[model samples]
Target chain A: MADAKVIPFDDDRSRGGGAQRPVRRRPASGGRRKADAAAVRDAALSPLPGPQTGEAGPGPDAGPAAPAEPVRGARSAASGASGDAGGAGDAQQDGAPVTAAGETPVTADGGWDRRIAGGLAFLRRRITGDYEVDEFGYDAELTDHVLMSMLRPMYQKYFRVEVKGIENIPSEGGALVVANHSGTVPLDGLMLQVAVHDNHPADRHLRLLAADLVFMLPVVNELARKAGHTLACAEDAERLLQRGEVVGVMPEGFKGIGKPFSERYKLQRFGRGGFVSTALRAGVPIVPCSIVGAEEIYPMIGNAKTLARLLGFPYFPVTPTFPWLGPLGAVPLPTKWTIQFGEPIPTDGYPPEAAEDPMLMFNLTDQVREQIQHTLYKLLVQRRSVFF
Target chain B: MGKVVLVTGVARQLGGRLVRRIQRDPEVDRVIGVDAEGPGHHLGGAEFVRADIRRPAIARVLAEHAVDTVVHLDVTGTPLGAGGRTAVKETNVIGTMQLLGACQKSPTVKRLVIKSSTSVYGSAPRDPAVFTETTPPKSLPSGGFAKDAVEVEGYVRGFARRRPDVAVCVLRFANILGPCADSPLADFFSLPVMPTVFGYDPRLQFVHEDDVIDVLRIALHEPRRGTLNSGTFNIAGDGVLTLSQCSRRLGRPTLPLLLPAVTWVGSALRTVGFTDFSPEQIRLLTHGRVVSTVQMRETLGFRPKYTTAETFADFARSRGPGLLPPETLAEAVDRVAAALSIGVLDGAPVEDGGPAVTQTTHSSGQPG
Candidate 1:
């Protein structure tokens, strides 16, 4: 009964809306599954005693041993089956289930033998009815353990990401995370997801609002859904906010991701500030996020126009290495990435009716865009080099 | 004061049981149970009168009984009770038309409760994340009970317009499942090998039969006097489960079928004699549908006793297990695997579980 909270009208928009995290904390089992899933994924990805036989590659064609997404959401319904979550602390003997080495499961689930065994165990549980996904197809067990681990190597060692002003991220409740988008491919969004999860004070998961194209690709679509990225629509965003999730949005979309290398870091129009009206309607704050060094990851020099149209991509990016170096060129350059979270722009003060005002929306959109641009400039100035 | 009550479809188990339940209440003087064919079960403390609601004779029955309250339960979604497609449509659409015609003329009929289905909210690729009470369905149901429900709700809305004095309550119930309640979803879940679309596992919601009866009783007992009460509501237990989760819990292995091959599977199911396994049902299995019950709780003032998981669990319990024991070697292995999973999962979080991780306790403590 306590958590049956309808969207309260009396949002204390004053910055001192302190420590509202208790009412806003996600249901423990769901949170724990994600935390645990990510934990498992981390263990699996970490280098072990054996050779690196199968690392998940980072290209349009990721290897067969790609970062795992569940057959189900790894979320929503099945993963929320916290009925068995309390038994989480019972064993340390999973690592050598086949060999009976009696070593802990940390090394066990990570090893190649244990990898196949762990995957089988996961599959067996799914078939036998232990794993469940929530409505959104989110299996925290899958996302944290499988999807996140797949993205972690690129996030941690490759990019060598530096995050700043994470405390500016409100600890709880809904806040619209507005960020600049760039690169021939939008790896920035994925890196930001990793950054938020790894850096935020609460280790809160960022539900990125993605475009339809992301959900159109078969494997890519499923992985995006499992990782908590939803369709970039107002209805979806409002639902996430109402449930107290920190929503991430990149307004530039294809325009940001498909820009010429010459125009990189130059802010594009914020799509008429639809994201602002979403925040206004939901009565949440807007946190401006500035991502630096994503521009050089894939420098788009020219567009292979016919090829792009043939393949249904916005543009076929002609980076210096791409189409020349072939498959290997699809791998991103290890640019030094720095993500800064600026102070939040409060939207709760306005009445819900204000979302209807175009002029007001335009101004608020400008306010958010200006804040992000300023931060991007500041961070860019502070950077020593492109690759660090 | 007690009101004279008339209940339709008393031939069905739900209507029959409802009539008996209402008869015990001191708020009624007489109970007129109308059905074309009487159920084999006894209807104590109530009068059973054979009447075809689709025919004009229903108006005579309504006037003769002076029925002050009407509980229309004959809008059957499946052919199991309604016979054929035409017959189900007639009972759902034409029968509702005739019943509404009768109620319109009868000055005594001041309160109306029509049982509707959430199937009216058809499944589609481009639907809203959640359907509130007022959200127009994405794809309207085409030749099934779902379509009939849409038309039935339309007529009820029309009736509300013509006779503002009458209290019209339209309940859009989710797939109803319980031990004794038989419906299409129940039949499908009851199958040994449930066939599902290969790549999709849509979200599912359900309302227990007990909750359905309880809400119906609440509707008849507590009449609303305000503006918001007359509107439609989506009824389902809290939380949701995927198609995979439901089949797994039911202990039925799902045979994944490709998209184009799904209709054949549906026809195969129908040939095997499942009533709700039409093309519309195929769409539901593929996309799945969910409706918000905020109106059900905040405005309608009734909370389901069972959450989604608990409701499905009840159905699974009632259905019992298949060839295996309740606890199998697989389950025993899972318990160990789950324990291993938790330990491995919790290990990484220990390093990441900074001061913020403990903040949940701190915040809960702050309030204290």
Candidate 2:
């Protein structure tokens, strides 16, 4: 019950505002994976002074009471996975009273002033070209302050994404998160990134592997690169994993996202498991994830094959309201969404040669595929309706 | 017992500077500067020999000097004083061939240093994030300096095989940027209003012109205890900058055009004799190139003083002021910050005040 109060709509933004505060510091504690769930619960319940209490009220209760229950579960599960981040909760608790006691004088005015100063500093830095991008062209500062904030509203209010079993992801180290792709467009990927970021105790970023088409397009190419998405190739994937990043790959590619409305939940055949070999070579774990509710967002009833070929697209989706409604039909429907991260399959136990072994790669790929398919079926069965 | 060095392309700015620096080295007894034309400027104390490397006559000069160390600084991206694309190709490709042939026959030539450009790694959508020395280019250059560099490298490789005894070192330098840089990229950045590809902002890397001379100097000399030896290495500074970032730092406004329009503008500028806006250069501006400098550090045993950003900054200082002054931009930023904070404090949140207060307390007490 105490944990339910922590589900604020803009916690991520609040964290951004307090960029100068010591609250952003990672705790110096040792491994405490067992305390993850408790830490998350305690962090949620920690008291905050002033305006935050007013803002937190409408976030979770925006939907029905039934949906609010799972959101609490989602937060707990997310926190549980990042055991080392137990220190984050304790640190916040220690800082809470200091802010609360000084609520009137220091907290209210100082917070807004600091936020405005930070905004100005950010603008100045961007204009003066004072920023660092990694070799893969990932701009972490821009993604955090600008891009993530832009997407948080949609992830929080529109689909109301609930995450489950987040504890399955390792708090640190390289990980390959394999998820079934859907939603006519790949909005699910963005939502999945948001779910992992907001729920996890450590708030680790997910570096997504995108297709070549993403890089070929004009505006999308620059945005995608800035948002830390690299080409979905073995070299890039291996390079990212070797650097200890959490990489998200959708092996199904266009096939899963462009499937017809008749086969919404039926999992498509994942392409030759290149992701598995990449993980094996890097000696990291692979976490299988299943996303529900993205399929119903657009509800593709038919594929316009002729138009697709003409436009040089994989498929031109003819959704229920699309084409007839023109630009207005582009908006996705409001559907209740749930994303579940399953247990990570460790590939470190295998020999270095295992990456080259076709049999082992194929078997591991099938095992991961089956686990995601099974979870999808279960989540579908538990659902009361498409739109809650 | 002292070394006799032959430095080609002394007529150009960089070559003249390099020849002057090499002449000062105490270990070298003599330095011979060779080119098609005599040096217009000073070359310190180095002997100037007016001879074309593209002809067989270069062999007589190489043998007469008994040049043991040969530094090829002639491979250029654009025509320097008075030459076109064809002239550039002849000097780069044919010149290198004739010089290598002379080196093969002249037994005194034991050390060779060739300056190659990173444009050989043609930019494309499918390229790796960072290119190492061994990474084959994803796409071969269609035409221009890039293709010429690729061919020149190929000939160098063949020459290396023939003379395995020769300590041949090939240095592939990234876009050279510095106070005295006369590179195509430098000229492009110096334009009053730079034209950019509409949707793409490419990540570019640069090495200081001083660093190139330093690396070449090390490569030309014989291997001592802990210095460069014979091998192919990528030379670049420590960091990368986006094309947009470069424009902003230079305080210049960009004219974003569609890809086709950009191509049209490139040729238009070329015809007007503004700069050599070749197709390869356009491809570079579209999908920028970056190379790994690990070998340059560990294997070659050299560390560049200026980073990519610092090199660009040095280059930017030489070019005069832009339309938008730095002080005006700074003042605007400060004013906006103050106004925004004050506005938020006085208004907005209070307008929805009553409803927000009740909603906050209601939600907080509901759990209890």
Candidate 3:
């Protein structure tokens, strides 16, 4: 038999000097044969295997010699549903379609597909960048990003974080940011970081000294890293402060965050003046900050220590609707967070060896405590809402 | 006609004496004695009511008695044993709370007299300016830190604020000493072998039991309303003496064994349950503490009947020879050296001649 010549799909010469070739036709069997021929013809006319690779492939363990007919049929069905063939015909008459996948032919500004693409790209970068927490100990991860995103709208709209006396935060030196912890979950610390970053003239990152339990969670562990939190160790605080970094600490810590709702604003304890000792040792200024609105967010009505121990948490907080509301109650009330930074108490005058003097440490601690208490009363009067 | 007064812990040394003193006052119509262990063996005159002040129900009992004045003297536990600090706080703090609550409900009650210790002052710079009622107490590191001092004050302050008609007086007392004084001072003096002193020149102060009773009597009758320094005075017989002088006065030989700084030893001793005095006590002892009684005398219009010397003599007479006689100066030094050789007082600093002794004959006894 004479060899039939192969013709390229887009070869100009094969199309007989610029004349277009006829579309491939199928034989009519006038019955099931005709249906089968129609199916084959439809499969051949569909777009090639690309983009949706997994769906086009044959079932695993299937013989490699399996006919390409079934795969082609699946591709044809997908292309038809998407109207790709119709678009292809238009492109054949003109040039290739000047549009992206799933995009409208017109370059409309409000196209959903374009917006989705841009959003996906942003999400990709957010998931991969330095802000992305991944490692076991430290990394930016999804929950942190989600939380930040969830809080961004509210932070920008109703919550106006104004950092007063920011110059009190050493620009190049380590500083101990002794803030009052209020809310059951300590969202105040989070807002503190945001406030420092957004409102500080230097846009400095405030490394928070968190409790032991915060880093103990699987998911929250990574999130904490991205948020730049470390264990609330005197050594860690001293190191960071000595390095000239701004360090945030809650002297009240677990006691403050877990205090009974009746004692909401009353600071429980300052923990034996460790913070003061750290500040004195590092010779850094202690910036006293008071956060209002957090106490109202998740008022710690009670605590279940047994359950907390079982769950490896410090104290299982029982707010009004928490645990009863389950996951929903975990969502903090969108309280209008107002963090006010008081003037920094200069440790410059304090002798570096003052850390050894328990009396001196106590005096300094009392001063810081008095400042926070005084500011809290003022901020409480100034706050407008329990939740926005 | 006289006013009725209720006193708790009336069986204890200070409490028993206070009850006796209150009974002798012609102005006291009837004295009510309350204690957890029934009436104390020696308590007399006052009606006995057995009740635990820690229980809230006692407050009701107090109200039922139609008590007009309350002299709170019961503390949960003394600072002498395991959980002593906690026990003391519970009794002193929580018990005070219940008592104050009772006073609040009783319409007949006109005054509350609280016996607070100068321990709240901790170790402040000894400026020779005696600690006055106006001076804020220095915060302490121990569990007692301002717990009793501040909370009792708060309760009384709050009570007065709520009912301006009632008068609340807090008496900040210095170390109380005398015959049968069951305080840590008595215990320290009775030790088989005295603990090594950090230095040789620490000053000591003591107030006679008679003076304490007199102050209590005055507080009950005096129309004063605010906080006051009651019995604390520089009761060192008008002069400060070195440790050697104190040992000599007690007929004990001076033993000079160097121990680590008082702060370190005091802290270690407190942790190991060896001493009742807190780290603050060591600081106070090594540094010396003296509060003037000018206001206590002028405001209360009372004078101390016994001098520091007379008080010490009475204490010695009461104990007789059963109280360990002071070791001979050379013998005391040898005993300390032996104890140090066995590492019993490890990390103790070396001393020159002997432990610092005060001229006051109370002796360096461990406090109960």
Top-lDDT structure, candidate number: 2
Candidate 1 Cα deviation (angstroms), residue B221: 2.3
Q: What tens-digit string does per-residue lDDT give for candidate 1 at A189-214?
A: 99998777755647578889888777
Stretches off by above 4 angstroms in model 1 are: A1-137, A183-186, A212-224, A258-262, A293-335, A377-388, B224-229, B323-326, B334-368
Query: What fraction of the native interface does candidate 2 get right in terms of contacts?
Result: 0.29
Question: Evaluated with DockQ, which candidate comes out highest?
Answer: 2
Q: Order the candidates by TM-score, highest first — what do you get?
A: 2, 1, 3
Instruction: Compose the digit string of candidate 3's lDDT tens values, residues B1-368.
Output: 68889998886878877887778778888888887675435666678888878787777776787888888876422542335577777777788888887778878888777777655555433222134555554444354534566666677677778877776667766666677787765655554444544332344456677787877776777555554433332222222322333343454333333435445655665676655655555454443444555566666655677654455556656655433243333344445445544222222211111011110111232110
- DockQ of the two-chain complex in candidate 1: 0.09
Q: Put the candidates in lDDT order, highest first.
A: 2, 1, 3
RMSD in Å for candidate 2, one decimal?
8.7
Query: Residues A1-388, candidate 3, lDDT per residue (tens digit)?
Result: 0000101122111222222222111111224433433443334322222212433222221222112211222222222322543333333322311222122234233222322332233332221121222111222222222334344334433343333455567667878899888778877888787666544545466888887666444335334644667667665566567667799999887888887778877876898889988888888889998877678778778899899999877789998889889999887775555566788998878776878999888888999999999987876665434542
Residue B163 in candidate 1, Cα distance off native in Å: 0.8
True-contact fraction per candidate equals 0.14, 0.29, 0.00
Question: Which regions of candidate 3 deviate over 4 angstroms?
Answer: A1-388, B75-83, B125-129, B138-141, B145-147, B222-244, B253-275, B320-368
DockQ of each: 0.09, 0.21, 0.01
Off by over 4 Å in 2: A1-110, B224-228, B335-368
Docking verdict class for candidate 2? incorrect
Q: TM-score, each model?
A: 0.76, 0.83, 0.40
**Between candidates 2 and 3, which one is better according to TM-score?**
2
